[model samples]
Target: MSTEKCVVCKGGGTIELLGAQCPFCNGTGEYTKTGESYLKSHICQCIFLDRKTCPLCGKKCHHDTPNKPKILIGPV
Candidate 1:
């Protein structure tokens, strides 16, 4: 997947210039590992804005699984 530059951190992954993690990306200018993909270094929560994406697979679905915040990544 191609990651676009973060609108907030602009791909720098930090804001305020204090080394503080960007609230939107948690320091990952693109996306952060969240929900069931916590062990992963990256998550598609940001990539999947509709929130219907499968955590185990990158398939978009219509299931009603409540979004859990294992580590909330930003929305694309």
Candidate 2:
């Protein structure tokens, strides 16, 4: 279950969540997690290619970000 091609609606899947709104960080999302400041300027995956907003919960989207493997000690 790993697909690719989305880079900001470039794949035509869908992308557009309040575009063109930067104005010196007026979006008020968040950043400065450390040096170089994180957030990458108000997310730029175009907007969220498609719409489900799940890119591993990283912020942007484009596929390749779904990895949920946690068993710890399972046996069922």
Best candidate, lDDT: 1
Residue-by-residue lDDT tens digits, candidate 1, 9-71: 566777553457777666777754432244233334423444556343344443333654233
Give the TM-score comparing model 2 with the true structure, all chains together: 0.18
Query: Which pairs clash (backbone N, Cα, C closer than 3 Å) in model 1?
Result: none
TM-score per candidate, in order? 0.34, 0.18
| lDDT string, candidate 2, 1-76, tens digits | 2243333332333333434433223333222133124222233232344433433224423333343321122222
lDDT of each: 0.49, 0.32
Clashing pairs in 2: none
Q: Pick the candidate with the highest TM-score.
A: 1
RMSD of 1: 10.8
Number of clashing residue pairs in every model? 0, 0
